[model samples]
Target: MRGGEKCLEVFCEIFPEADLFTLLHVPGSVSPVIEGRRVVTSFLQRFPGVERRYRHLLPLMPAAVRLLGLGGYDFILSSSHCVAKAARGGPGAYHLCYCYTPMRYAWSAYEAYFGGDRLRGAARWVVPPVMKALRRWDAGTSAGVGEFIAISHTVAGRIRSCYGREAEVIYPPVDTDLYHPAGEPGDYYLLVSAFAPYKRVDLAAEAFTRLGRPLKVAGTGQDFERVRALGGPNVEFLGWQDDAALARLYAGCRAFVFPGEEDFGITPLEAQACGRPVIAYGAGGALETVVGLNPEEVTFPAGFQPPAGEEPTGLFFTRPDAEGLAQAVLRFEAEEAKFRPEAARRQALRFGRERFKEQARRRFVEGFERHQEKTAARRTGDR
Candidate 1:
């Protein structure tokens, strides 16, 4: 599962009895926790071959979301990265949307999802108008939601910019217990990610290839073939691995590479939980997660000196390119001894499942109370 599905699993644990509404669901694709719930899929689920080719059906998502009747539920919690946030609830129901982002494809990430190479032929012409319409609809639907909760400060900024609405930030959960270190570091570096255009997996593959170091990439997606072609003999593509295999890989790697700009990246935290230092692009959620040496703190004439009692867990490269990543790897090797495994593991513990659950409970209670107060005030004004 990706970050969004992992979030859905946590929601399932919180509201086991709540009905799940989604565009489509592939049976056995998600965790048992999510699958066990009474999943209420949209009209999109009835279409043949929708499971594998869902991206092709993006144009119809708004209509499909509207078709889902949420009137029966008194309280609605939508785990949304897309049209799920636009689901209409009953008139009296309180709706809270856990917004992953305000539709990346329809907004600033248009080129990443529908650029010249990504979308060809008639699609090139067709998609732009559809996305423009989707953007308008997305902004209009923001009023339907009573409150918004963002997964990260990064996403909260986007929500504010795109919809003109402020949102509370709640960092998502990571299962630290499942990713404990084995106390043995392996020779190879690691990258567990999907081969999407925006993920920048190709950059890591190219960097490792140029350096002639082993880089094990463990996940598959639409751009897998393109990413594989860019890699040399040093880069290994290990298509989607099971939890056992992923855990082993995490525990053994010298360092984890995260080249993508994510909403709230979970894989880096997972790697940190396994006591592995990370080499990440200095952007997005990585800015919040990774503790790196600051250039501003160093005096030029004094030269590089390790901070007393500070154990850095990762290194960051300002640019998201092969040369930048290659330099970062070389820098990490030079200061490799300063990064303690225990310190990385300690940092990962801060975003554990229990912390998320407690925070979520408090937010839900407070939001519900605010909703009631507003409703009571409206009634009094009418009198």
Candidate 2:
């Protein structure tokens, strides 16, 4: 019920289920968009101070999922970033989990979650034991799910590593059609991100200040004050923006600077759909989504910094550092023409909403049908 809420917003639209199951909810805490829908929380409902230390509530998750009757549903889809993937399903039921990443707090960013950062430090002092207990619960509960749909190949790799389970990569959806190319380039580079430690917006601010390029950042989070404090003359931080405003920014921007090494960056695709070229860390969905221009032909590399002349659909920083990002931004402006509106549009087409829906439908139906066939064969043999 945090950043994973964004992915849940997309999945709920696609599948359109009747009842939504979750661990907890703070009314009006999440966006009003999900109101009126029946959200069934786990047994930890109204537990004293649970919302504040909710990550600690992980131990209760298995018990909560077990409380959900798998036998009662025709299809059980879990929009998970964590153990929501671990929800059990009966033999005939189909459990489709849209995984964000295999538990960031445990696998990848363990130190960061418990590191000397203010929040982590506070968590350590207050809820270290609970966090430890939940991690153990999370590992055990992961074995319950029937199938996993990863949001990115990076996440699919994590799924393999943590659960010893394979997952199909389904790039998260963006409203491409809604974010058409503005056709008029603005004077500034743009950033649309929540101020999280992992996002590394500090690098962007530093680079823009050094290079003397105007940068406008949109979105807000816990790190907002720190991020703003780091900003120099050329950087402007706009707290948060609506879709219309964000689309306008995407449309008119010279380029979209995405500093984070995201699992799958919806923002970059959104920028490309608006015919603005992306400057992203070369990793995760950027590998599959953005085509690097090389002289020989267009090729998609697995991580950042593709071979030159690859159509410049987007420029990738060699790594996630200020200097690398600055150089990439400079290179993007120098070779910006190669990233034509038509080419950006063409690349964005691969991640269109319709394509994603069709793929999901095919996979879900195919998997469910196969399960049915296997069940039928087993029953017939027994008879």
Candidate 3:
């Protein structure tokens, strides 16, 4: 399961009685915990093989979301990156949205998703207007939600910018129980990521190629062939990995390399959970997660960069390029001994699975009660 599904698993444990809603759900494709729930898929689920071809059906998502039978539901919690937050609930329902991002394709990732100048035929013409409309609708739907919980402060900023709403940051959890420190660390640096355009796996491939250092990449996607082409003999692709295989890779690697500016990077935390250090681009979620080694080299916030005595858990590259990454790797190598594995383990523990469950449940219960109070007060005034 990906980070989103992993989060959903926690929700399933939290509210076992609540019905699951989604645009599509391929049975047995997710965790057993999620599968056991009473899943209510949208109209898109009626079409065969929609799971594989869902991204191609983005134009239909808004319509599909609206058609979902959300009536009579008193509490709705939408785990949303896209159209799920727009789910209109029954009257007096309190909807809390755990937003991963404010629709990246319509905003920050438009260029990456659309791939300007690479488009051909009708898609070149048809896709643009649909995204424009999506942006308007995406922003408009924020009013329906009673509260917003961001996966990271980085995402909280995006929520403020896109939806003009403030959000409380609740960082996503890492399964530290499954990913613990074990065995001797290996010589090669590691990266376990989807080979997508935004992931910038090519940047890692190119950096390792320049440094003539070993790098192991895991996972595959639409941009796999393109990223693979950029990698030299020094870089190796391990393809998709199961949980056991990924935990092994995390524990064994010298360091995990994160090339992209993610909204909230869960994989880096997973690496840290395994008592492994990370080398990441010094932006977005990395800023919040990584306790940087070379504070002067990277622009950290008021605390991390200034506090010279803190045991650094990772290194950060200011420039988002091959050369910058190569240099960060070199810096990590020079002072790698100073970074204690235990410190990384402790840092990862701060965002453990149980912590997330506690916070989410508390927020939902408290907010639901307040919403009921306001609803009752309004009805009294109406009378």
Candidate 4:
């Protein structure tokens, strides 16, 4: 499961009977924890080839969400980075959103997703106005959410900026049991992410090309061809990997390469859980999760030491481009021996799946009970 699905899994365990509402639901596409639920899909699920063309159906998502039936439920919990936040609850119904971020498409990710070579022809011109309307709709609908929980401070900031709303930070979970350290790491560095524009997979391809080092990128999405075009023979793209294969990839990688500034990434922690250190861009959620050691020669002064006092789980490059990442990789190679597999695994343990489930259950229960009290008072006053 990806970050969102991982979070959803915790909720499924918390509330087994909660109806899953979405614009689309491909059977068996997600974990059994979710698939076993009473899943309700919107009108878009009926549209021909909608599953493949769903990202293109952005303009229709608001309407699609509106058609979703949640009449009987007084508490609607949304795991959203996009349209789910717009799912309106029935009168006095409490909508609790575990936000990944304000919708990236409707926020500052325009240049990455719609600009440059990512978007072309008439559609490039067409999508901006749609995004603008979505931004308004996104902000307008924030009123429905009784509370917002962000996966990280980075995402919490975006929620405030986008919707003029506040959010409590609740870091997501990683399945430490499933991702524990296994065999020895291999020669290649691993970069696992969907080829979304903001992910900067193209930069990873370019960085490995410059270093002439082995780097394998797992997962594919809208920017696949563009990223593949930037790579040399040194870089290999593995389309999509299952959980078992992915665990092996993480446990066997020399180090995980994370080039994106995420809301709060799960992959790096997953890699750490598998006893792999990460080489990442020093921003966003990476700062929170990674115990990043900066290079003495480059990042610090002649005598200056970068200190975590215990152990460093990863290395961070202040620069976000290919050259920055390539240099960080070199620094990582130089300081590689200092990083231990078990140490990294210990760091990953702090964000274990069970811990997140506990936190989620507590928050959801508290919010649901508080909402019930408020609803009772309102009904009593009406009488």
What TM-score does candidate 4 get on C-alpha atoms? 0.93
Judged by lDDT relative to the true structure, which candidate is superior, 2 or 4?
4
Candidate 1: TM-score?
A: 0.94
What does candidate 2 score on TM?
Answer: 0.84
Where does model 3 exceed 4 Å of error? Answer: 296-309
Models 1 onward score TM values of 0.94, 0.84, 0.96, 0.93
Q: Which rank order by TM-score, best down to worst?
A: 3, 1, 4, 2
Note the residue pairs that clash in candidate 1: none
Q: lDDT (CA) for every model shown?
A: 0.86, 0.74, 0.88, 0.86
Q: What is the C-alpha lDDT profile of model 2 across 75-173, one tens digit per residue?
A: 777777666766766666666677887766666666545566545445556556766666677667666666788887777877777777888777766
> Of models 1 and 4, which has the larger lDDT?
4
Superposition-based RMSD of candidate 1 using all C-alpha atoms, in angstroms: 4.1
lDDT string, candidate 4, 16-105, tens digits: 877788789888888988888888898888889987998878898998887787767788999998889888777778899999988888
Global local distance difference test of model 2: 0.74
Q: What is the clash tally of candidate 2?
A: 7
Candidate 4: give the clashing pairs: none
Give each model's clash number: 0, 7, 0, 0
Cα deviation of 276 in candidate 4 (Å)? 1.0
Between candidates 1 and 2, the one scoring higher on TM-score is 1
